[model samples]
Target chain A: MNKIFETPLYAYSRSPDQESEVAVRHKIVIVGAGPIGLAAAIDLAQNDIPVVVLDDNDKVSSGSRAICFAKRPLEILDRLGCGDAMVDKGVEWDLGKVFFKEREIYQFNFLAETGSKRPAFINLQQYYFEEYLVARVRELQAEGKAIEIRGGNKVSAIGVHDDHVVLEIDTSEGPYNIETDWLIACDGANSTTRQMMGMDFGGRVFEDHFLVADVIMEADFPTERWFWFDPPFNRGQSALLHKQPDNVWRIDFQLGWDIDREEELKPENIDKHLRAMLGAEVEYELEWSSIYTFQCRRMEQFHKGRVIFAGDAAHQVSPFGARGANSGIQDTDNLIWKLKLVLEGSAPESLLDSYDYERIHGADENIVNSTRSTDFITPNSEMSRVLRDAVLDLAEEHDFARPLVNSGRLSVPCTYDDSPLNTADGLDGPEISRPGSTCPDAPFGDGFLLNELGDKFVLLTIDADAPELVEEDGIAVTRLEISAKDDTSGAIRRRYLGNEPTAVYLIRPDQHVAARRPNYNENLMRAAIRRATGKE
Target chain B: MSDLILTTNIDHADDFYAALLGAHEGLSKADSDALNARLVLILANHIGDNDILSKAIDAAKSSG
Candidate 1:
């Protein structure tokens, strides 16, 4: 078994705030040192914003909870300076095979195209993911970035004000008080911060339970996702198997609604199921086992006054699509830049409302996809089962039925369509890179397009004339010029330019497209900058 | 105008109905339901157009 979780990477330490005469105030306080909170702290600190993260626990997550890291989050982590470590340590695979009744129905390759830097998905233990984020936080701290993570500091109470929020944190020594201009809740699904605020997290709750067992084993199974429906071993239920790093395999078994949880989670019972699935000859040791029932829910609004909610604190989705932490990372990616702008007074506080609007959009997309996948996997009604089984049966021989099979749709980046921050698109560019879509990465110069854009509002002009710098309403927009002739693979042209010879795109600080045109206009570009920053 | 032809498009309608019924001749209720589900999926794929398929579903519901 891996010993990383047994050690405290962020062991509790006494801070000056605990011994202060009065409550100390900070620019921003993030509650929870999980993936989202740490990523938010790193992003804000990289932007020169002082942020503090508080959590009750001192170690990384105990089990390999969330195992799949999608490409978009990997890109976001790259911006946060920890992507290389994750990808290097993670098991990368794009192929997924679906099985029904001991026969392979169909297979899919998630990354069918080329020129992107990251793979479609990587399977790394969630503990390793958190450890990398914490390591990045340490590096930023060493570089004099204003980021502090206080372990064993739990927020027991919260008070919301019009201007700032006050938190009562309980430490090992005693309870202390602190104030923050902004409060970000990166706490998990059962968020104490959210409970203190009395916010509503409403959505559908799936009635089925899933057992996840992380086993340390030496198996020759290829590094691909394998999902089975109605297999002979686990007769009626579904099963999922994925390869994580360090010779660890994560297996999930769908146990029906009315089973004895404690009895089923027994080591003997789990061993029996594993022996049946892996055949009697296989050898393995159980590293961690958990039985989880999930709900696809979110708060009505992510931003409530001075207090903002993010990650599992704001929304919870079924684990089928791997949306939980992936979308949480995206939540912070959509939030920190806006919070930074609000703090710097470059944009109005209402600009943060767009965060509520956009991440809710992302949360809804995740909820819908996950709910559908859950219904397909664990059909509630007899007719639903009949149709689901029909799809599976036909999928064995028919190509059209393959798409109907939904083991899990997998996580993909959300496009903020109809976003209030997006300016009207003027160019007939590729629909995938239109206004309100995440910028597709392409080979640019020596690196990728996303690397070139970095964390800034960029005017990406391809064979188009645009000034190097454009400042509108105190927001600086830099230019990244690329000629179509220089793109050797033509990926840039296909992804960004479409059929247009020259195109200009206004990309946001979060690397989402804000506006685009075939030719750059000074007045229009300035208005776009204003609209993108919520000055409109 | 809806793309789904609600009018009498099948020339041998009676024969087609006979064949549809003939497909589920000797199956139990569960097997018949599964067969019907598969038939719906197959014919839906053959139709391919979501709009027409949706209209056909509406028509089937209203007729039922």
Candidate 2:
């Protein structure tokens, strides 16, 4: 057993609010101290917003779930001060190989370009990921940042009010009531908050199950993603292998729908499957094993009045693309800044609707990709299987067929193509860095570009002049000026500037571009800032 | 003008049909279906035009 799960990091304790005569009101109350909830708490606390996180469990997740962390979320974690520890402990890899039968068909590298701060993806167990986040929470608490994570505080009931939300929490001491100005539900896919609120989560439930086994063993397999389709050991089904830290390897075997849950979960049965895949002589211990049936679904709206949903509470996708936790981290990234503005009265509450709009777009994109990957991995019909196998057969020899092969598209940041907040394109810059796109990280002087952006709105000028500070609707936008000539690697030029000699970009707090122009204009910059903050 | 050559463009239509049938002469029903699927994919790749492929699909569906 893993030692992290045995030790309680945030054990239950009595709180002053538990003994109060009246239900104490907090600024924000986040439910389920998973990756998403902890990230939201850390982000809100970093911005000086008081937040309290409630979780039913005190320890990290028992199993090594959600093993792949993409680059964008790593960058978001960097802003929250937890990226360094995670990256140091994670197994970084960008290459993935797809196999058909006994032979390799094709391989892909996610990050072929250079100058990015983080890799395309990293494999770190969810327990370590949560531990690092909890460590960051403790650091912030030490700094007197108003943040609290109460373990064993399970929210049993919720009352929605126009201005605030009231929560009934069950604790070891007793049941206590608390109120908050707002509620952010980061509770995972089986969200109790979502069920209690009676929000409808609608989507397709795939008809297949997958057995995930985390085996601790010493193996010489390279640190890369290896996916097999119809292998000898697992005939007519797909399998996946990934390396994690501490010599733990994650193996996923596609188990058909009609499987005996109890029989398959037996240790001897799991060991038999492992022996077949890893050969009889390879020594390994089954650290964790479980069967899961994934669904691609989401609520219609992320927020209803004072209660808001983020992460798995808001949406869910098949785990094939690593979109589950990565997108959940992005939810907090897109949400916390807007929440801060609303809390400070700097922006209207309606700005949060854009969170629903943009994140729904993101969720739909993930669902489509995840559904496609699932369909390819587990073909439903005879014709679908024939076509899928045909593609794999041709992919081994043809370069064009390689693109047709589907083995989890992998997680990537979604560009808000039709976001309401985006100002019309005013510059002929690179399409990849256009309005409504996350700013691509490039190597700047001594550091990366995203590191300099931090967590605030900024006017990034490249060989263009802009005011040092621009105030719009009580929101301050600072300027970060750089010259195109100083770019030694030309990554900035290729990513941000395309044949444009100078560029001025208004970047949102989440590092997404609000607007961009060839040169700065005071009225246009202010208007972009207003639109981005929902003051327009 | 459409990219898909709907009009007959094969120099020897009977020869092409014979070759297509000859490829699956000794296959079972399942193997024949698999061969047809692979052949469609190969020809689709050779054509390499989405609009043409979509039109061909419509034509095939209507014909069936």
Candidate 3:
């Protein structure tokens, strides 16, 4: 049997929802089919949670939206089973060059270090990401994972209850209501769910407007992030240029506070800037153009009883650092495990509150970074412009000013070093791979450390005896022995075990380090497992 | 490093100069002077070398 490949965005035909099929209760319902929404749905389905996803649009979103995906989000997408496809489809970048006017002032070389599996970042059209996620969800569904996606279903109303949520969705056929045990709002920045609840989503909104033009051309531009404080093309304002998958180059021009949106988006207006940047001879087609004002804000709480918000529904940041979608994807990664545990009644609902707390910290970190980048690029006051340019000028010669040069601090996975979920590191180890941080990926015998760890609460023992962990539903324990043969170079030992031969790492299903001890004992392992699975 | 690395480092000197002045386009005389002072302070901090900054201080003041 031949399986025909379908275009994800446009091929989704709007199916009618019957009024009689309205009142059925669902385990999980996710709103929005963007990268984050589909990711949430796919993750839940992978965890054996039956989910129904709704979206206002039937087709994948247009343009080179959210092209830059950081490595952490890439890892999260990998766990959801879509990382390879995205990396294969996208262009990998490990270097970025920041220019003061036409002169290149500073450059970032992420030239991969030893034991690093993924590149620093990759650029792929957001539509392709959505497409791959949808494909993965369908594959999971075929395996009886129980995930249903309803396109063209706009959630018109949301009623959050103590035990469940009732959503009034309007489809092409008509309007109907569906009750969900848990409703994950993966809706975007302008989330209808956010508005329906009238939650105060507060943050800073940048005054400057940026026009993003995805220009399709066959010309060869090296895969690297090129950012400018004041480029030769867009004078007095900042500009950015990055390569995308389909010979489409995303060029952003800062248009300041006032500009006619329609007038700026015109072909001639965009062509003038493109001609200036890439030279007049480089012929290109304008694939997509959009004008946007960057904003950094988030809800104080992402959870409201049964209705929980993830991604842009909960927070938004200026897109300079490519944190918007990347961070949103991470939100789903942080959320799904806790959500699955709560749904299965294996863990107290308070476990989900940890998602709210940790992700809010993540959002706040993103907001701080994005806001600083926005301020640096588009100086708020006269003195700000002075110091910003000074940093750029100094950055060309001095190493000290390089760190201060905030051309969208390249997205790095934030370590939840002080998370409540982590058993405080009682032993000594590298700070980077400490508890409350992501389980550092290291080359295993033939696979990676993270690949062997996730999908369950697993313990990794370095040349040590395996703790006799009792097998229980949602609380089962498995041990992985990382001996010298498993990693001949001792990369796992260097990153995870430190100098100790018998270090035990209790990793969560989300691949975050829950607790660790240099001396692995039955009592310590049992206690950590209980705390990790939300037992005690 | 000491020589005037003409503003045209990447072949857009004239355009860049125009843009630099353009940053002061709508400013008053006092504001334009303030921008120069700020640029000077910023570049000095970036240079960070007392000896080099001192040289620049003298060079910018000295007549061609």
Candidate 4:
């Protein structure tokens, strides 16, 4: 083993090592050891770039918030070598039931029509998920990757001079100075870095407060998502129940804005709510519980000088659609690739700007959608509740109301309509044909699926009719043909192009459509690749 | 002020990446803007010196 790997710190000094403190700048500095920051470190360090992670947190929080993982983030976890562990530990759920006044209103099976190795979503506590990520970071460090993790180190100040970012870091011992080429602040919604930079965080903090509890149950219950609306005892209250591993279930109660924060968090109060939801017959012990308020807000900018933000640092969405952490991870996914390209000299620094462009749109979209969901689920006004209940009643039986009953909005991926990398037919296409939307799965050659075509840029053309475009200089492309009637191909055609596209379509590595043409031409095709990759 | 697009409309490869930078300028998310600039400078430092990006930072200060 290398001397550096054997000893991460240059020396174990009681006082700050003065000689070793000669502005030892790293290629990148990451703030916060959360999923987004850690993912950024893993990707950058793997590519041989020097990285240092800073966090004020001495230990991972035991808070069991954010209990769901969507498909896109699973792909990212797969890339970082933690996907298998996540899948093993997480409970896959494709079926969810919505209840209105103690009756099932409508049910939807996520696995009903699609076939893929990745389910629609999985349920797992965020803290355990963090442990899995930390393990991967440790493995990478053992291999002499230039990734450094420093916990309990508060970033006291941030100053971006034209040449580098100078950070004032407070350690257990004393305050010290660390210089970095660039900084990423994944420090979360209450980002001290953002505040230091003097950026505006504009949004509304809703009047409603929710009590989230992770409980260990003694009674047997079906493994399904049980969401209740307007229960009898807690008038104008709602509850969310999902089974976690080890006979534990995460439950949430909509305890309107008026309750005392401390009293509501008490174990007795939490147990009372759980028993009320589960009925007194079902005995349970409390594992963990916290009272949190939901907010619909976003930062004015994700980037300022050498410091960038991701996850909660960038935006905070109410947790209705499970967009908070998932969206942040997507930001990491979007930024990491561009950062890699810039570090490797394959792309310019400007490429990093798209991270802000792409992800902010995602956060904005999430806030709007999730806020709407919060309103529908927990209507503030009596008239609105009456209207909602009436709608739920209609949703139970009327076939016409079924689709309306299922807003089908939560599962819908946020569209990046404004991405500079977006093509003319980009995110604007119908959900199926949307270029900037998640690439739909379809059968390609000899039974290999379209999603199998993920992991690299793919240019698919329906026409075996058009001659293959010569592979461009720095882009990946593929072309194939299948009859419209082919089942797998039919599904793909239905999902993506609405109908099978006549010409050519290019998909980005993240599975969003980059470009499409009515007919395939080498120059036009190459142009699309250049545009998406920012060569033009 | 509006949604940030991840894909570019430009057909040329060079222009597509250029659009990525250009689009970031129009981003509305507060965190997205600050983080985007930070990533650009950080990535730029990995490639070259702190000259251009540093100048941009200085310019931002004057404008603010």
Q: Please, what are the lDDT tens digits per residue for candidate 3 over residues A25-46? A: 8889999888998998888888
lDDT tens string, model 4, A1-536?
32211222212233232246475676789999877888788777766778888887645546667778887787667767787788899988877888877677777666634644466788887776777787788888899887777876789998888757988887767778878878999998898988888888899787898888888876676777877777665667887888876677988888998899999888878777876777888767777888888898888777766678889988998888788778887887777767766666666677667777888888877876776667667665544454456556655654333443323245355667757777687322246556576665544555435445545567666543555444665454665544445645366556644543554678766667777665666777777777777676
Candidate 2 lDDT over B4-51, as tens digits, reads 554435564333433554566566668878888898899999988899
Q: Which ranges in model 1 have alpha carbons more than 4 Å from their true place? A: B1-64
Stretches > 4 Å off in candidate 3: A1-22, A471-474, B1-64
Task: Give the higher-TM-score candidate: 1 or 3.
Answer: 1
Better of 1 and 3 by DockQ: 3
Order the numbered candidates by lDDT, best leading: 2, 1, 3, 4
Q: Could you give the CAPRI-style class of model 3? A: incorrect
User: What tens digits encode model 1's per-residue C-alpha lDDT throughout A200-271?
Assistant: 989988888989999999999999999999899998999999999999999999888998999999999999
Q: Pick the candidate with the highest lDDT.
A: 2
CA-lDDT, candidates in order: 0.89, 0.90, 0.80, 0.69
The candidates score, on chain A by TM-score, as follows 0.99, 0.99, 0.95, 0.86
What DockQ does candidate 4 score?
Answer: 0.01
* Per-candidate interface DockQ score: 0.05, 0.05, 0.06, 0.01
Q: What TM-score would candidate 4 get against the native?
A: 0.78
